[model samples]
Target chain A: MRNLKMTIQYDGGRYKGWQKQKEGESTIQWKIENVLKRMTGEEIQVIGCGRTDAGVHAENYIANFHTNSELSVETMMDYLYEFLPEDIVVKSIKDTTERFHARYNAKGKTYVYRINNGEVRNVFNRKYTYHTSVKLNLDAMREGAKYLVGTHDFQSFTSQKPKTKSTERHIKYININKTGDMIEIEVDGNGFLWNMVRIIVGTLLEVGMGHMKPSDVGRILEEKKRSESGPIAQAKGLCLKEVHY
Target chain B: MRNLKMTIQYDGGRYKGWQKQKEGESTIQWKIENVLKRMTGEEIQVIGCGRTDAGVHAENYIANFHTNSELSVETMMDYLYEFLPEDIVVKSIKDTTERFHARYNAKGKTYVYRINNGEVRNVFNRKYTYHTSVKLNLDAMREGAKYLVGTHDFQSFTSQKPKTKSTERHIKYININKTGDMIEIEVDGNGFLWNMVRIIVGTLLEVGMGHMKPSDVGRILEEKKRSESGPIAQAKGLCLKEVHY
Candidate 1:
């Protein structure tokens, strides 16, 4: 079997996350696999690095699949490009070692969340940004995010109750920046739990809006309770920016 | 009557254009006017700077309306902001001189056309840019654009056949710039005829693609015939960037 690694970019607004669902539900993986079936006449089991919630976008999502087709990479790329939807783009594809699995080899990830903290929204970027009229306190949000960095058991940050799986994660950095009325929060980490990034963002937003103190973040993390965290932020503002192997 | 000058922005992907058409047709004007009627309980007529074609977006389009209601600008702004669709945003509103007309008083306007000149399109900006896999020669397009700048009777660069009306227009500048894979063409002019900017862009694209020589632009203008120009570019890539008073 020939292992093929691919770099993908997609606007996940109309998808049911990355994984394939029952039959009719649309997904990024299902879309590519469907296109590959037509091109190779073989059922291509494409593996994604990770799953992204509905309405989340991605810039450089990594994936891999094993195939027996002897077609050139360029020919397969051209065929896939012609068949895939406009919102989903296959940036590049190449041969890879058999053991270079997409999911297992992923070492780190970076995500970006955009907030339109302006009274007048940006019409051009309406879909990609979450609009909030309330003025956000930047310094406070930055201070709050600092508490979430570094390795710790982040049980308070996720939606699921991890009974057996360890919830410990090492967050490298959390950077909050504002340009014009757009505020972008970039988070890089070794791993993330279900709804973890959104919950952390929500807690920071609470601090920014003066509802919670920056010290509350440390308290919430220590509590190890899901109810201690803030509400989950909207999925539309979140984007999978990078995946490092 | 208070002559209110308002700045508006919209993603014109969904609308037919800026003007109100039939009773059921949706347009920027119709959307705003409908909101005003609900707010003031009066039939309000909103005048736009000019008409934009279908799927054309705007960033800082100027418009005006005469209202009899003694409502504060902020109150009206809030009502409009709350009621208008998310794709349309009323940026600002203020009382202007009674004689200040949106269409007639305009001194000049600036437009921007974006081209995604890359093998793989930017998924986030798919709606805002025109994607062409053909590698464009930037220097050639710039060279062709120079011939169209400055004062000239652009008879061949418009869709409408002007008989007695003056087709003379003073084009201030036409700048072509490339950053990463995005190429932006900015055109500043005193006024434009129907589809003049679109036709001009189409001709420049033809030059960039090596279909026509750069000098052909000069000859096309000299011919003063509609058939001499290239095809009209797509409306989605065009945006009304600014309107000068």
Candidate 2:
């Protein structure tokens, strides 16, 4: 069997996320694996870099699989392009070392959340942006972002149960930039827990709108309680931007 | 009675077109008029500056309507915002001269067509762009575009029947610009016949792909036959960008 790595990009608006589920439930993994199985005549399990929540998009998702089929990478890519749905695309495929696991790779990930700070929605980009009418205090948001940019147990930022394995993760940076009424919050970390990025974005928005003080973010993280964080932001605005190996 | 003009923006991915049809047909005008009728308790008719083909988006579409309702502009805007589909938006509404007619008092319009000259589709923007795998010659397209800038009877560039009133229109400019994998064809004209912009884009694309020479464009215009032009381009890639008053 040869290990094959695939680079994927998808508009996850209509999908139920990346991981495959039981029969009848739609997912990005199921779609790709179904196509791969047909092409190779083998049951394939696509190992995704991570799971994306429903309605969340990804720009550079990586996955790997093992197959005994001796198909050329170009032929496999063309097959995927023809068989997969328009929203899901396999950008490239390559032979990889057997030990290269998509999930267990020692690396980091980057996520981006988009917010439209316009009084009215941007008609063209309405589907991908979280529309917020209230003016955000960027300076305050920046101050709050600094408190969370380091190795911390982001227990309060996730919906995952406390009994789960280690919640400590190294956050490399959280950059907030605004351009023409659109705000992008980029978060780079060793890893993220379930709903962690959404919850973090919600908390930062609360700080920008004066619902919470900048220092409150540090307090919430120390408390390690889900209730201490703000509401989970919408899934449609969050996108997995990059995976560093 | 008062005249009100609305600056509108819409992603026309789902609608039949801009014009209202007989009952049961989905249209942008029908949706807006339905909301206005409920808001005003009076029959309403919205006049658009021009018609856009189905699946053609618009960034700054202009429309005017007459209503006797005494409601404030802000209240009407809020009603429209709440009732209209998420894809369509009224960016602004204003009181205008009673003689203002959306179709008659218009001046000129600018449209843009986006072509993705990439081997793989852009997963995020696939819905808005036309994907072309063939390499386009920018210098050749620019040469062809030069022949189209100026007032002329564009009888050869439209799908409209020849018996139509007049095919003459003033094309102010045709700009072909390439940025990375995207090529934008921006056309500015005083008026356009049915399917004029699309057919023009199709012809220019043919020129860029070496199927036709740059000098062939002038001959095609002189021929004044619809069959003399290239195929009508897809509507999804076209967007009405501006309407100069």
In model 1, residue pairs whose N, Cα or C atoms come closer than 3 Å (at least 3 residues apart or on different chains), thus clashing, are none
* Chain A alone, TM-score per model: 0.97, 0.98
The TM-score measured for candidate 2 stands at 0.98
User: lDDT per prediction?
Assistant: 0.93, 0.93
True contacts kept of each: 0.88, 0.71
Give model 1's docking category.
Answer: high
lDDT of 1 by residue, B1-245 (tens): 89999999999999989996678688999999999999989899999999998889999999999989999999999999889999999999999999999999999999999999999788889898999989999999999999999999899999987675788899999999999999999999999998999999999999999999999999999999989999999999999999999
Off by over 4 Å in 2: none
Compute the lDDT of residue A233 as modeled in candidate 1: 95
Native interface contact recovery, model 2: 0.71
- Model 2 local distance difference test score: 0.93
